[model samples]
Target: MWHMARPRKPLLSRARIVACALALVDDEGLQAVTTRRLAAELGVRGPSLYNHFRTKDDILDAVADAVCADVDLSMFEPYTEGAEAAEGAERAGSTDGPGAADWQDALARWARSYRAALAAHPHIVPYLARGPGRRPSQLRMADAVFGALTAAGWSRAQATHIGATMRYFVAGSALGSFARGFVDDAELYARDYPHLDEAHLLAEYQQRVDDGAFETGLRALLAGLAQPRDD
Candidate 1:
């Protein structure tokens, strides 16, 4: 009697490798991600990973790009396209226009989206500040921000600075752990630190406090960017 051969395991692909690496990082922080660990997670040999990635850093870069790909870049599209349309309309004597306010709105939306993406994968926050480099998703994000700003009448220099500024704010916000640092007990701060009387409140309203702070800072940054500039 002939028996059917067991179905073969799905062949490993770069996407599968990157996905497994990301899950590892998500579960156990970036340091937990190793070729051995990934291979084990994938039920493959360590050398099998090298066939897809040159080194651990290559896998990490792919992970970072994957995280960036999750960011909502659609926010920039309306403003970028609207600005272009407005410019064309202006040449045709139309009064309606997209302006600095539009750019500010788009940037604020982008900042929130960026922060949310990073917050969801806090494990990757440490690597994001290194800039997009050769990562296509991150590069696309940067290009969208730059394109929107420049289209809204910002000079190339100003657009570059704004992109950097937004990136700094979003990354810095994600890096902070203000709410998590507070203890739930009021007495924890009662003795030597009366100024910390509100410590319990922090634990009670941790998420609100963090979100409020982010929004406050984001609004302030966008407002400042909306100001008229000589350059």
Candidate 2:
């Protein structure tokens, strides 16, 4: 009897798998990300993927962490400097501080960067409903936000609350527009909803996009948060 040659191990790695999954999500949307699909893309069998990730949910969680890692810190870097000080130290400097700034402006920039990242990976937003603690990069991202806020004359307790609020707000903001297209971005019946028709709601779909909504909400949040708190 002749001996058969064994199959070679694939060129795949966990990082490659995660990256490919993200790209698939970006191009065709998240629903396209399946182990079978991913394996096919990697030129391996679906079972080979399990050798790296246990289940689809595990892969999704990893993808969420990967998405958080992509946030742009360039805008938020200034405020994060000296952001890790103790009470009355005048700064919060930690070489490891989140996103690199120590003021609300820094936080705002950080928020925008985060929004951009999520917008790029819309499929991963739903997984964030559970919040950031589950993933290492997300938890680090959260820590940076809290650090920046606390450095800006906000208390640690207050910073935590504000950070939570911002995370929820940004996640919702990115997803809201995505949800809109889920129904229809086209015209509705003019006979129905006279007020909406009169307002030209259907025609100016692009204009209807409130690009400033995030800034407006951020300003409002900071203004309210900066005020003296009973606690």
Candidate 3:
């Protein structure tokens, strides 16, 4: 009997499909990620992709999850439980202060990191904003934020509200660039608005202007939500 030996590895996989799909999404918008286009990008046949994902949406789900995986969730570790929580809190405090880190500080770190991850793939934000769905990483992120808040003295309802609020803030921030929308035309603003004198320079310092705005807004939001709990 002549038996042919099998190849050491398969020609395609779910991970490869997702990586290619994500790259396509990052390069083009979600609409650009068709099965044919994905197969073309991966140097494989369209049928090969079917071996991994049953549909284009499934591929997108994987890509969205991959983006969620990039978000840093370590900030919530401090609010866990027991001795581990104490150590994590100490580490967080070491970064923000000499005392145990406050819940505000933990959330601030998480929000900044989340915004950064989304900013890197602004094209994918719309799809991600559709909600976590069955994405493990996205769900895990939601869990961490809610759990940390409840542990830090907030009621369950308050924790849910805070999580939703922070998510909205971060997602909105990454949806589009505020500074980049401004034009470097001092004359335009001078004749009309009469106030935006330095508006012309905003385009040149887009990063600084936008980052400062995010920090300011983030602080204000957290402070506003800091009132005594009703629940």
lDDT of 1 at 125: 85
In angstroms, give how far residue 120 of model 3 lies from its true place: 0.7
lDDT (10s digit) by residue, model 3, range 1-231: 998898675568898888878888888788999999988877778998887788998999999999989999998876665335556767777432223547898899999999999999999999999999999999999998987887677888999989999999999998888888888788898888777877888889889988998999999999998643877
- Residue 159 of candidate 3: its Cα lDDT? 90
List the candidate 1 regions with Cα displacement exceeding 4 Å.
1-8, 82-101
State the weakest 10-residue window (summed lDDT) of model 1. 97-106
Q: Between candidates 1 and 3, name the one with more favorable TM-score.
A: 1
Error of 1 at 182 (Å): 1.2
By descending TM-score, how would the candidates be arranged? Answer: 1, 3, 2
* C-alpha positional error of residue 43 in candidate 2 after TM-score superposition, expressed in Å: 1.6
Best by the TM-score measure: 1
Deviation of model 3 at 122, angstroms = 0.6
